[model samples]
Target: MGGRLPMSGMEGFLAGLAHPVIGPDHLLFVLAIGALASTQAGGVWLPVVFVLTGLGGTLLHLAEMNLPLLEIFVSVSLVLAGWLLARRQTPGLAVLLGLGAIAGIFHGYAYAESIIGAESSPLGGYLVGLATIQLGIAVAVCQWCQFLRLSKAGVTEANGSGRSVENLLRYAGFTFFGAGLAFLSGALPSL
Candidate 1:
């Protein structure tokens, strides 16, 4: 599986989309970052670090040096993010950025597994497509969070304001935790 990297632009993009969507942890990670970005400072940099550090991981995979516990790390990060979101904890900017960057490494490593032997051209496209989609998802979610924050949706940070978004986040957090648990127990499958 690791040796069958895509060789075309379309293939690369499809693989990019598949990698994140098929992995519940990956999608939850994006959701966590997006929700955090709108409510926290330097949220904008979270996706950047995720994509870049992930690419670094992909490079490591290509070099044949895998971090032994990458999957466990991914699941752990997902659970922690879910906890933070479930509790409505808005962390400091530095903490958010740092945690997001660390998460990125796990994600990038996973992404790399699919593109192990990709040629330079396809690899470039694969990286761009993956980064672009994930970034776009994060930004779009961030905007949604921002709108909920600013709109007269009859919500406020205090007194259960943003209840809908909060509930969604809570649901997402729970879902992430469940998925992580499932992944850990080998119930659900991942690439």
Candidate 2:
């Protein structure tokens, strides 16, 4: 009789870390965007939109919607997000929603592809886990932004009057761009 093999503790730990570490490019993308969003608006809704969009994107990917030029889209997101952050201009809710939705598609695709053949029930659980992690990261970033805003270190007056915030956003955008590039180059393995 054939027997099923169980995962050892270390193996399990590694398996768990795999998704966050290497399975999807979304982790980096999400974090980058979260940092940028925190700088723009210190609210939970922004990250919520990001999470929802990612889930929506996953659903679309499962439906076999081919997002042609996904790499380019991600790259653009990074660039635009960075620009928005660096500029310190207030982004309308509609714009945030649109960006989140578009970015989420790629994120979801990566997640879905990573867990193919896993139990359907687990998919929801996985998404919840993903959302929880993202929320934590977003909150942390928001707190950091608040600290920066309150601090007087290197604070500069810019055209938008939120030059510090803009710098944060620019950094976030560049990080996102770098992450996307790494993913595209296959330097980071996707599940």
Candidate 3:
């Protein structure tokens, strides 16, 4: 028999937490979003909007509205977001919020796939964990951005370790690009 084993309640919650972390695309998407949301104008609200809009995407998935080439889009989003962060582009609050929401939609839809058939309690816990994890990362990034004075515009002076941040973003960008290419290759068979 190839039947799957049923998970206990706690196991379900833990699995929920682990799901996003398990996928590189998912993790990068969230981290890039966190970096952008933390540093962009109206940073405080953009993350919130991202989370909420992502929830909408989850709803769409629950309704069985699957997006084709989701993996490709997700990987591309990671590349774009990482580029934005690496370049330290200071887009307006609206544009930042829009970016977050767009990325959130796809992420949320992907997130819901693992929790299908979950009970109410575990589902609730999963949603809470998802929000908590993303928000926590966003706040952490925001702290780094503020402390390094990375978010402020028109400052030619490199706040201590600015070079380090740029290097880190560069590495992240390369990784994102590599991952996106991997996804594209994986998807080739289907197309």
Candidate 4:
């Protein structure tokens, strides 16, 4: 069953690792976080803020805490994150991290749904998987953006490639924007 707990620690770990990767919305949002962090000072730690708050959110859910219109929050987070990525000028570290914090709560709450009723060992493994994967992805994305030399502004290099990493990132931003809208549309109908 979708709601059933994992039978073992390994299963829980796999499930947690797959959760964000399988969800396009979550995947895009995390990618944007990396892209966003790349342009800011001390930006690499942004994912740490996200992951810590995300763990907090999971704990809240496990405690049976209720967050109203959670899907809406999650969808809106994607929209906000996408908008940040799509913008030519970047915001300061505090602002971006603030957004990441809020988004993390919603995302983590959603993640908690998959691990409900899990044993302590499985739950530990799940948390580790989630943290490791999210952190790794964000760091990798930041490095990739740097490697591509993406400017603070969405500038396309004149290289004959005709497409630049900045353009690709901007395109990704638009994609996330569209995905958020689609998800938001579905979530709103339930309200």
- Segments of candidate 4 deviating more than 4 angstroms: 1-3, 150-164
Once superposed on the true structure, which residue ranges of model 3 sit more than 4 Å away at CA?
Answer: 1-9, 150-171
- TM-scores of the candidates are 0.84, 0.68, 0.78, 0.90
**What Cα-based lDDT does every candidate model obtain?**
0.75, 0.59, 0.69, 0.84
TM-score of candidate 2 against the unseen true structure = 0.68
Tens-digit per-residue lDDT, 1-191, candidate 4: 26578878898888788888998778877887888888777899788899889999999999999999999999998888777777756789998889889889989999998899889988988998898899999989888787777453334555555666666777778877888999899899999
lDDT of 4: 0.84
Whole-structure CA lDDT of model 1: 0.75
Candidate 3 overall lDDT versus native: 0.69
lDDT of 1 at 116: 74
Winner by lDDT between candidate 3 and candidate 1 = 1
Which candidate should be chosen as best, given TM-score against the real structure?
4
lDDT of 3 by residue, 30-81 (tens): 6666666656556877668777877787778878897887776676777677
Rank ordering of all candidates by TM-score, starting from the highest: 4, 1, 3, 2
- Per-residue accuracy of model 2 over 1-191 as CA lDDT, tens digit each: 01211134333223323454453455566566666656455355677787778777767776777876665565556555555665556487567767876777666566566544445555555666666666677667766666666766327544446566547557666666666565556532331
Ranking by lDDT: 4, 1, 3, 2
Cα lDDT tens digits for candidate 1, 28-67: 7887778777667557777777777878887778788867
